[model samples]
Target chain A: MRLSEEQYELIEAYLNNELSAADRTSFENELQADSELMAEVTLQRDLRLGFRAIGISQALDKARAQYNANRRVEAVPADPSSKPMPVTRPLSTWQYWAAAASVVVVLGVGYFVFQQTTEQPTDLAYNETFVPVDELTKEFPRGLAPNTRQQFLDILKEYEAGNYSTAIDQLKTLPADRQTVHYRNFFLGLSYLANKQPTEAIPLLQKALATPSVALRQKAEWFLALAYVKNGQKEKALPTLKRISADKAHPFNLLAQRVLQKIN
Target chain B: MAIRPLPTFLSDQELYDALKRRDDRAYQYLYAESFPSFRHWMLTHNGSEMDAEDAFQKGMLSFLLNVETGKYQFQASTQVTTVLFEYCKRVWLTELKSARVRTKAAMPDSVDSMDTGNVVEDLERLEVVNTVQKSLSQLKDECRKLIEWFYIEELSLREIAERLGMKETSVKSKRYDCAEKLKGFYAQNAKKMGL
Candidate 1:
């Protein structure tokens, strides 16, 4: 859409940290190519310099609050951070994994939504989980009496449709039981792992592994080990895999064997 | 090259300039002053605190993007506060609108006050920014240091991770997490300050 004068002016105003993302990015390109527009924008930027700019510093309050001093994932000194650098930095143990989950939540969706540095692992692994969260069932599947098999199918639909954020939120509200619980736990952990936030994923996978059901036990153990690996604890992971691989009949035993080879 | 302070471009006018110059003081001043109000506005309608923060970080990113791309301009004497407020509001509103969560609109009750001489408003906005900066000082040592390192130092993801002894990929994700934590500090303090 050809931007009108006010639209152009509004965009320029926004550029001085005045415009929001929903608006700025949509028109950022158009402003770049227009020179007269560019001059007008520069003038506005100059005048506003003395004025304290606007931004959603609050929205990111989560990031600012808790810290992983031990992990050092966020401890990089800012020197030319404009470029996304390669990182093989160890994903540390998660202490206070609050709600800013978008980073690793979507990793299993297969997009690499965020880039990585070379200091980190060269090969990225994709594993999804599902767990029974009460709140998730309300938004996901309205009824639970439809039989365990069908409930699992419906829950799978939610994961496949990419409603993980919703799934995670809802799962938080649900009790840890019910037949579909395992599935929900599995995928929820997977979503976190996918987003590359294994610290968050580890607990959920640990919970999934805790379930007494043999069906879930092996799978949960497999992911929990992977979660440990992602968090840079190959030592802890080695045992988890070794225990699972001992169960020759377990479905995930084969997967566990492959992982044990890499870490061991 | 008399090392004349590079004339500020229209786009590179806000925190990005100080950020590019690795000026932690200016970044702290700007971040502490503005984050709470943005957080308050973002939390409208039972939205998670993270939603507001995500929008906030995204807004800052867009601001930097515009400045870096050389598309930012200043003409009207609009304070940076108004611009950023408008930006964060628009971004949050778009999210709300897209989610189709109907509620009280985010439009301001009055902006006609802006018609007054721009210079006066600039002073008022600067005052607001200063209030935020003071609030930032209230943050604990780790939080404060982290913020200073990030926006001010402009460190790369890998560099920050390595220095901090964190995984690089984890650091990128954690920056957002830390930002959300900082917002919590701003909100709690704003409540006490009654701002």
Candidate 2:
């Protein structure tokens, strides 16, 4: 049965439990009398449930991947230290002096080892935390022509494929306006960052912060901070990092806090 | 040794809001805060790391979907992590219970009396969704994208029209047509799969 727009909305409201008690009772009565209406409701409910299930499944996969990536970063050291934790032992007079000399040499190596471990966390945080945005997973921006939409998708596909240079060239072909402006700036900035052109990434990310979508703004702000860090502008990154750290709800909150601790 | 920082928010509501928006930071923060303890519980309960991981993911997806759909009403007294652990625990328990039933093994004493009806039903629904999702892949690229944008992403007709450079009226009709095509494909696939 082909339902009219109003009928579809009414059925959706009923199925979603948004209907008033009186309306719900009336709808139940209608359902009892009309087999076609009952069938249509069932179809609508199943379709919705199906979409929701699939959406959550995709999200779960992404979350699992993110969790695994984070776990891998913290689990093992790239460079193992030569000396394990020190243990105390009683020593003879001659052995004491010999041990003292060895201690000095050990201290020298200790400092180098300390430097290696300390340096790793910051770089590791950047590398492990930055999962390249999947373009197909992202909702395409509204209002492009069919060709433009295809073009945007092509650029996104290239970006996902690590062809940042080609993606950047194609991104530049897309016109910017109120609707397309944020997306162009954001994706272009991401492409630049992935291409190791953080200097070029900064301005676009800053512009992307002006987007109406809070999610897009949050993404832009995050990459903007990372861009500053990448460009060796740690001082500029500080404010954004602090802001993210302060906002407990931000997706980057914990990571921002970690990065801030390392650099500080 | 560097200590991992905890998420900044003090309340579950704030964290839930971030998750609903699909914020990666929130996802990561929740992973750090909740997964370890849940994994530990799983290990003690005769579950392996892989089992824990799978349960955690499924539980998280279920919880988030409920939150998104307004099926989960927040309780001021319940910590978000605590609730999440319960969800993960239930998923594992349900799996264990079914495994025992299938193998004719003794039921473990650790199995609680909590209901597994919703979790089982949701899993079954997920199977149907998976089947239909594969069917969606068989659709022409334009029709698939159109239906996905409108239904799955819930984009407004105006926004969709803007994206495709079509008039709102045309986009509205296109949405209907695309939905019908998707339903046709889904019905055929569902019958084939006996779903």
Number of the top-ranking candidate, with lDDT as the measure: 2
DockQ of 1: 0.02
Clashing pairs in 2: A142-B163, A143-B162, A143-B163, A144-B163, A248-B9, A251-B25, A251-B26, A252-B25
Q: Which ten residues in a row have the lowest lDDT in candidate 2 chain A?
A: A106-115
What range of 10 consecutive residues in model 1 chain A has the weakest lDDT sum?
Answer: A97-106
lDDT per residue for candidate 1 within B1-195, as digits (tens), equals 001111232443554565433343344344444556776665564444445554554455445334434455543576565666666565555545434434545534333223323323333333343334444444554554455456534567778777789898777556555544544554454456454
Which regions in candidate 1 have their CA more than 4 angstroms from the true location? A1-144, A147-152, A175-184, A245-248, B1-195
Local accuracy by lDDT, each model:
0.46, 0.63
DockQ of 2: 0.15
Q: Residue A188 error for model 2, in Å?
A: 22
lDDT over C-alpha atoms for residue B62 of model 1: 47
RMSD after CA superposition, every candidate: 22.7, 18.8
* Superposed Cα deviation of residue A52, candidate 2 (Å): 3.1
Query: Mind giving the per-residue lDDT tens digits that candidate 2 earns over B1-195?
Result: 112233467578888888777665576677767877886788789875445655776677778777777788777899878888888888889878887787799885657465889887755665565555655655665776676677666788899999899999998777777766766777777777677
Q: Top TM-score: which candidate number? A: 2
